[model samples]
Target: MSRIEKFCAAFPDGDAERIEEMLHGYLWDSISVRDTAVRKNMKEKFYHGMVLGLLQSRSDWLVRSNAETGEGYSDILVYMPDKTGIVIELKYADDGNLQ
Candidate 1:
């Protein structure tokens, strides 16, 4: 079976399309982080994109961000239907060529 099929089996009545839309929008918005904060912002945004992508593609998942931390999270958190949560963390590096 396809991955979506497996995912959907866990969430019979959820809208997969809406999940895709949210993931697309979240990823598209993340592209704006180019060189400004370079190291920090890109990693955080990429991690966030991954979390959002999962939330969007999988019906049995609900995602949330902690506004209190204000971008200091290890990664975005995704709560899955299996009653488990995932924290996605991203790390990036500069080769000393773009100082």
Candidate 2:
């Protein structure tokens, strides 16, 4: 198994692809993140991926999950690279209380 695959196995509830997407976000965000070490690592990998065309500056992708699992709202939300806005609305409202 790939190194990422092995790491992801520990997060059985997480999709490997989703983790990649989050990593992509972490690598590409315009603002600097707090940790220098992690930033350096991700930046190197991201640049390599970009050089090889594995990732692009603007790509349409979304990380979403809706199921009985405790994943909750989108862990990462990505807009289409085309800059089109997609709307999500609730047909019903939830009470402030959680069981």
Candidate 3:
């Protein structure tokens, strides 16, 4: 199945583990030999654009970028037809330290 199919399967029930698994697949699959910046100094914007673009490819879910959530702006916001929402926050790690 495609990313959207996997994501749709994981969307309901609000299972964070499955959603994160989808994120992992996306993050890894997105890397390519043409994109060497990731190994050098890729910024968070790259991730944001790629993810946002992917989310926007499908019309079944509502997708937004830099969405305002009363408290602050989210990196990406996705809402299902049933009104379920997923807030995605992208983080960049430096010097191989994820913490």
lDDT of 2 by residue, 1-99 (tens): 654444333233446566456555645663355433454335444343332232222234432322222445422233454564222212211342324
TM-score of each: 0.41, 0.21, 0.67
Clashing residue pairs in candidate 3, if any?
none
Error of 3 at 40 (Å): 8.2
Please tell me which predicted candidate would have the highest lDDT against the true structure. 3
Candidate 1 on 1-99: residue-level lDDT in tens?
665455434333355565445545755766565523455546646655565565466655676565234557544566676676555444444552433
Sorted by TM-score, highest first, which candidate order results?
3, 1, 2
lDDT (C-alpha, whole model) for all candidates: 0.53, 0.37, 0.75
Instruction: Select the stronger candidate by lDDT from 2 and 3.
Output: 3
Provide the lDDT at 13 for model 3.
Answer: 60
Summarize candidate 3's per-residue lDDT along 65-86 as a digit string, tens digits: 9988998999888888888888
Best by TM-score: 3
| RMSD to true structure for each model, in Å | 9.2, 14.1, 3.3
**Model 2: which residue pairs collide?**
none
